[model samples]
Target: MRLEQKYTALLGDVQRRAIGGGVPSAIGQLRLCFEALGLASAIDADCATRLGRHGLSEGKFVLLSLLRDVPEGLSPHALAERAGVTRGTITGLLDGLERDGFLARHADQVDRRKLLVRLSPKGEAAASTLVDEHAQWIASLFADFTPAEMQLLSALLEKAWRKTDRGAA
Candidate 1:
């Protein structure tokens, strides 16, 4: 069977199981899941567009954000960990950012074998602007949620993320 057919079959099985149980509505749960997915996609698209306006992509944003918080800068391995990207990917990103006049790489004084990556003045200004823009965007997005609701949502999302992270590990 095709991928869609397999997915539908699995969903149908879950729906049947839910219906057989005391649960009132599996359709509502499915609808909520799809809605959340749609919201996530929209947010990702908006983020990509905003980052692109600054001549950066999501990966670059992650790298720049990490650098913004660290004055001394970070090594490729440290950047990879902070950005949740591969070491090779971090290297490429640092190279591209450096070429674009957004960052610089220097040999680590303590560890000569490792290269430390730091943002240039231009990069720092760009990152600061992006951070402000993102903060405003996030505030607008969550404007409808009350403080309690926001806290609950944050907790729930963190719990789900932890579960997924554990499963992946």
Candidate 2:
């Protein structure tokens, strides 16, 4: 079924089940619907499935994407901060990536205790290929949207992001 039809059905159900009389409560429920829809879209898009078929986890994909522009590599601490993860989580991601030969860790010249993580040539190529594919998928997914509609949606989402607990990106 079309997404709009699904949304309409769900909204009708929500309105029927709504307990409060005020418009504010109804608006709050609608906001929750938007959140649910966003999550459902993400999962249904199956970005993770595509990445997995390429032997890449979401964590690895994120790391590779971040490392693509930095030939010099980034430190674990920096990567963790940028990725909004803990150092331990970074270690886990690095371990898998290293085992897959997609990335390598080198001793920091200035600090022997520190390790600099960089993507291998294979990893770089993979990153480029995966990024292109993902972009194409996203473009196709939104093919029905007009340029103006996309711009407006982007602006609205950006506004919501700015208000989120994570703050602006």
Report backbone clashes per prediction. Answer: 0, 0
Candidate 2 lowest-lDDT run of ten:
19-28
lDDT of 2 by residue, 90-127 (tens): 99999999999889999988989988999999999998
What TM-score fits each model? 0.75, 0.72
Candidate 2: list runs displaced more than 4 Å.
1-45, 156-169
Local accuracy of candidate 1 as per-residue lDDT tens digits, 66-164: 898687888889999978889799888988899899999989899889888888999899888887788898799999999999999999867656767
> lDDT of each prediction vs. the true structure?
0.81, 0.82
Worst 10 residues of 1 by lDDT: 1-10
Candidate number with greatest TM-score? 1
- TM match of model 1 to true structure: 0.75
- Measured with C-alpha atoms, the lDDT of residue 157 in candidate 1 is 69
| TM-score: model 2 vs. ground truth | 0.72
